[model samples]
Target chain A: MNKHPHIRIDRYALVRNTVFVWLTAVVVAGFLVNIPRINILEHTARNLYFHVPMWFTMMAAVGVSGYHSLRLLQTGSLIRDIRAMQAARVGAWFGVLGLLTGIIWSKFTWYVGTDVWWNFDPRQTMASLQLLIYGAYFVLRSALDDPDRRARIAAVYNLFAATTTPFLLYVIPRQLQSLHPGAEGNPAFSDITEPVMRLIFYPAIIGFIGLFWVLYTQRVRTAWIKYRVIRDPEL
Target chain B: MEQEVQSIQDSLRAKESISTPFDSIWTGADVPTVDPSALEQVMLSNDKLYVVLAVVLLIWFGFIFFVYRTDRRLSQVERTLEDRIYERDDEV
Candidate 1:
């Protein structure tokens, strides 16, 4: 049996089980706990536990992807390249989820009377742009025939993409006038947030990030196997 | 010690019994007899808790779908290797 030192299945089972239990508890607590309803927000405030975590998980995934990319630049390890690519792909999914969920939330809350599902909210636009950058990274990879050359070029582009992620998701969105809560005023976690909601909110973020880790690890292991058998790691 | 515990429980009960203005307003409101819109009927019921359920389920199913796709890839690789093994046996 050909064994790769980096790709181990032992840790995944334990971590996957833990993440499953943690997220289940998060869901129960998220629904069962009662939050103080405010005007406009109403019960949609429950979204605080779900919608916000998608961004947090995506940001964490970006950090993981960038770290692996930097390692690839240093060592030129194929494993590092595979890890970087898988992380970015999974992270992009999280960003897509965040955008879609935000649309659904706004449709009910802000666009109640109007039929506008895709208002050009600053955060929404910036996030979509960020996903596009990652999309270009994948396109750039596919355009290259040589694996070594592709990994090097994609790593450089991924580093640039990672650097822009924070600016696009947080900084630029805040500078512009927007309906997202934190943009115009104090950050979302201010005096108004209830202590009870925080109980589930923080766990939800951790659980979703944990979920990201599991998915990224799974893809990396599969890519490693394909790399060994078929000599192609692109997945 | 038993008496002390009983007293603490009694105080908690007393706290629950004390009604505030918030409780009064919530209790005094009439249940709506008018028909709710379809969206409201599905999403806004039970304090709009179903919305949270919807979001959670979407994420849950999304992750499940990813796992299934990855499993399929693994199965494909396994089949390819198995085919190669059969070809080697036939040659022998």
Candidate 2:
């Protein structure tokens, strides 16, 4: 058995260590500091700082999957294939986050007639559909019995699905009318976005990113172990 | 003869050059150019924020569930490895 020469334990612990202190200090500091809470913020309280970052990190992971898919096709590496799979899985979770957050925010804003699970608004409709399309990439990979063929096909599918992200996230929202306004104009919440908002938002993003890394590593490790089990039954 | 063979190999390599149409993802018909501001509202009320928070939380919980479920299966593989090693030692 040829082991990888240099082994790194995913460095997930560093993320945990750094983020715990960073998130705690930011929360405490935000509470102690005299920051003007905007009227909209006063309604949601302080959840924006926490949830929006999760969506951003998820987008980033999906984007990574696209990149890895390209690399895998070019080089035919299992490492890239595994990373791509982990990223897609993690990205899907974030897709759910973005959808839920948007739906909930809509309810609070409208305060009437939003029982329908989905609306045809560009952001809501396109985002969910985009996720659903990418969701099939994993199904395609898993359904195949041959590893080499599976990776190759999944890479192609991933590349195709990834092209939709830019459209769904930035292009479609802009082309058609959307309920979500911050995407196009005054992205930093209405009024003067306090330095305090940045203070919370930045670490929250880093924390979510760290959390994504930890999950991505765990998924990859699990996949590799499963491969090992099937490959070497006795060992 | 060597020069002729070398020329033949060069032609074969040239024939293998990988090129295809549709390399550019941003081609005709798919291009979307419009001002994003022409879209609708972004401001949400306090109640809406809570709903959004709930949805985001649910997603996070889902991530936790899937990750742990997959990770737990790794223990089974490790156990199988240990049993195999034990069986081999007993035979020795």
Candidate 3:
């Protein structure tokens, strides 16, 4: 119904908006660079540096949703279910963006043949699995008719699927062969991050996180409004 | 991530224990570590990327703010109209 009729446009968030703007500029100008005049970024062109953080933020959101889903099961509250579903929905969007950007970036830099469609890298496989797990959440949501049962079963599955995120996406791959280098010890970050990479990478993480929060609030507001609108037609 | 790492480590401990992370860092790759002389140059190059990144963030956020503001305003107008309808009904 999309009835979020009372968002005040949080001033703090607006002020916070400046951070992302600054971050994008810093990463673009400072990090998309090379010296010795050689383009170390090469065909990757700054995409690789920032994209990782966005993907992680999205993953975190889904993980939170899973956590909340279990909480909902314990409390037997629809509110928790709503929150979980919405978080997953938002995470799905971020996941899509990350995967697409990664693919396009790889095509330009990593792929060398007509077979630029997919790679067997740990990063790619894990990412694909993450996507699939979320896809199943949507399937689970729709497959059942009883609202209570749907929430319960979906919540349980959410925990199960989300618990594997760290293993499938981070741990196992880091343990196994990896195409994305430096992931063995620190997939989240590289300690040798040049001050330049940090300039971009740090803000990229901030900006993406801000975007996630803004979307999250929007979802929450919309959901609350939807309930109000549906429950009270007079209002 | 930490939990997963611990889980992996627990298994490793059950197996033969590695002396330290240094042994693992020297895993398959044999890339030469940088010398002290090149430290200054590496730092400068990395800083350049930061400048580029800052610019991109500004533009990205500016666009987002514009969209958010527009949406907020539209919602405000919708809410006001809804209020006016109720007020008119009362007056009648």
Candidate 2 vs candidate 3: which has greater lDDT? 3
lDDT of 2 by residue, A193-216 (tens): 666667777777777777777777
TM-score of each model, in listed order: 0.76, 0.67, 0.66
**B26-92: candidate 1 lDDT, tens digit per residue:** 4334533344455655575464577877887788768766775775677577567657756776887
lDDT of each: 0.82, 0.66, 0.67
Tens digits of per-residue lDDT for model 3, B1-92: 44644544454344344445644234444433442234333333443454445566677667777857755765685586568557867987
True contacts kept of 2: 0.25
lDDT of candidate 1 over A18-53, digit per residue (tens): 888898888878887778978888878888888999
Off by over 4 Å in 1: A232-235, B1-92
Model 3: how far residue A223 lies from native, Å: 2.1
Candidate 2 chain A minimal-lDDT segment of 10 residues: A1-10
Interface RMSD, all models, one decimal each?
4.5, 5.6, 4.9
TM-score of candidate 3 relative to the true fold = 0.66
- Writing each residue's lDDT as its tens digit, candidate 3 over A1-235 gives 2233334556546754675566556555544455223243453545655678768778778777987898999998876887888888888889888888877766665675567657777787888888899899999899997768988999999888788777776677777666465566544446544565566666667677776766766676567556555555665
* Model 1 vs. true fold: TM: 0.76
